[model samples]
Target: MYDRFLVSKQIDQWLAEDIGGGDLTAQLMIDPRATATFAMNAREPMTLAGVEVAGLVFTRYEPACRIEIHAHDGATVERGALLMTVSGPAQALLTAERTALNVVQRLSGIATETAKYVRAIAGTKARLLDTRKTTPGLRMLEKHAASCGGALNHRLGLDSGVMLKDNHIAVCGSIMEAVKRARLRVPALTKIEVECDRLDQVEEALAAGADVIMLDNMSLETMRQAVALVDGRALLEASGGIRLDTIAAVAATGVDYISTSRPFQSAPAVDIGLDEA
Candidate 1:
């Protein structure tokens, strides 16, 4: 669950950026005292997310705006399903409508994409994990949507975990050195993961006491060999170029986690529209 205060703060900042001086168009057409009702309907099937957050956006604009949500996050709704209704000052509803819709549709897109990856790896030992490739200010929200779609989150940010990628290895002399330095300062409970691009590095990382070893872009045959080499010494993560078409195979490699940024990169927004109710 998200903190209500933080959500309100974020919505307020968004409204500030969008509304600026005033809603000149709304002022030109609608009376400040006029009241109107609008209903949100899905234009296609999608795993809904951010419905409540969208409702909150309307309320931030006009506390009197009454928002009724029929579908909650993670629910798959068919075309024409009513998601919510907002009624209040016509000007306020019109002012907030675009922002609210944008939030809902964007999050729904991420949820739908995540669900596809999740379904692809079902019944496998591997769990679908979302990466940090998220919108600038919407990482938490997008990850929440991914969670709704049954994908696990990797690291929330750099502070959340220790991930020694190739760059770290390039700078630190070796994966062993990077893991050693990270282990020295990271909290006792913090997990240290090393990204290995080859079998030799995988062996080095495993021997260096890495809590998790990410096999980056390894072939199926290579992954199988890595799994055999690791022998369950560390949790194996298969990442890089994991897609719906290839996810099942990656999951079948016996890795514990399959991470990808594909869902966050190009999740097409679900179609939704607001109509006069």
Candidate 2:
């Protein structure tokens, strides 16, 4: 989740990046004293996520702008739904339009994509999880969008947990060694997860007392085998090769959670427009 202060900081930087020097078109064509109003509308169905953030972007540019939000975050809206309306100095509104739309569109797209995956895995024990594969400067915002779509958040960063992957295992010589080192270094309450692509490694990770075991890219049969092998000794997460087409099947394999980056990495921006009201 993002606080107003944090969101404001990000919006400020984005505005600076976008409107450096000045908005040439707005400055050249619009009178500073002229006022105008615009409505933000959804051009397609989407799970909205950042309506308020969009408001923040607009207000950051012009504090006196009056914004009326018609749709809230996490709302599932149909095409042509009015999302927001803003009225302010014409130049200010025009200058802030793109940044505001960009934030809401991108976040809504991520939320919509996450909702699809969440729906796919419904009626199963497996919970949807968002990965760290987020836009670099927008991890918190992106993760917030994923949560808005009903997916649980995974580790926010490497510091959130100890995840021993192939490289770490290779460096430490084995899963056991890697987990041991991590356990000693991390806080006493921190969980240690080990990524295992093979049943043999799953066994080793279980033996090493890993709190969470990630079944990385294993076949369904193998995943079932791993589930039976672990016997609830550790939480199992399915990762890699997970797609909308195969997510339900993966969930049926009985993993505790399914993790994917597709929702954030490849989700298409939702079509939204801010036009004269």
Candidate 3:
């Protein structure tokens, strides 16, 4: 769940950006005192997300607006399914429609994409993990959408976890040294994860006491080998180039988790529209 106050703040900023000084078109054509009802509907099948945010957008625009949510977040709905309805001053609804639709469409797209990946890896021991690769201000919201589709969030941001990539290892002289330094700097409960591209690096990371070892871009054969080499010594995460087509195979490699950014980074916005009710 999101903090309404914080989300309302964001909605205000977005409304300001989109509405500017005023809604010229709405003002020109719509009666300022007129009241009308509008229904939010899915133009195509999708795993819905941000329905709450959409409601917030309308309420933020006109606090007196009456909203009825027919479908909640994470609901999988078919084409033409009604998601929500709002009745308010015609000008307010018309002005806020685009922003509300944009939020739902974008977030639902991520949820839909993530669901595909989740289904691909079903029955495997591996759980889907979403990466930090998200639109600048929408990381938290996007990750929430991913979770709606059954993928577990990896790290919210850099400060959320310790991930030692290849560059960090290069700077620290070796994986062992890098993990050692990380252990010294971070709290004992903070998990240190090392990205390894080869079996030898995996061995080094495990021996260095890494809590998690990420197998980056490793072949299926290599990933299997890494899993065997790790032998439960550390959590194994298979990342890099993991796609809907390849996720099942990656999950079959016996890794504990599969990390991918495609669900959020490359998803196309789902079709959603607002129509007069």
Give the better candidate number (1 or 3) by TM-score. Answer: 3
Give the TM-score (vs. native) of candidate 1. Answer: 0.96
For each candidate, what TM-score against the reference?
0.96, 0.96, 0.98
Judge candidate 1 against the unseen true structure and give its global Cα lDDT, from 0 to 1: 0.92
Which stretches of candidate 1 lie above 4 Å from their native place? none
> Which candidate comes out best when scored by TM-score?
3
Q: Can you write out model 1's per-residue Cα lDDT over 1-277, one digit (the tens) per residue?
A: 4677888999999999899999999999898889999999999999988999999999999999999999999899999999999999999999999999999999999999999999998898899889999989899899988987888989998899999999988999998899899999999999999999899999999889999999999999999999999988899999998888999998988999999988889899989999999
**Each candidate: RMSD to true structure?**
1.3, 1.2, 1.0
Q: For this target, which candidate reaches the highest lDDT against the unseen true structure?
A: 2
Global local distance difference test of model 3: 0.94
For each candidate in the order shown, give its overall lDDT on alpha carbons.
0.92, 0.94, 0.94
Off-target runs (Cα >4 Å) in candidate 2 are: none
lDDT of 2 by residue, 1-277 (tens): 7788988999999999999999999999998999999999999999999999999998899999999999998899999999999999999999999999999999999999999999998899999999999989899999999998889999998788888899999989989999888888789899999999999999999999999999999999999999999999999999998999999999998899999999998899999999899
Name the TM-score of candidate 2.
0.96
- Winner on TM-score between 2 and 3 is 3
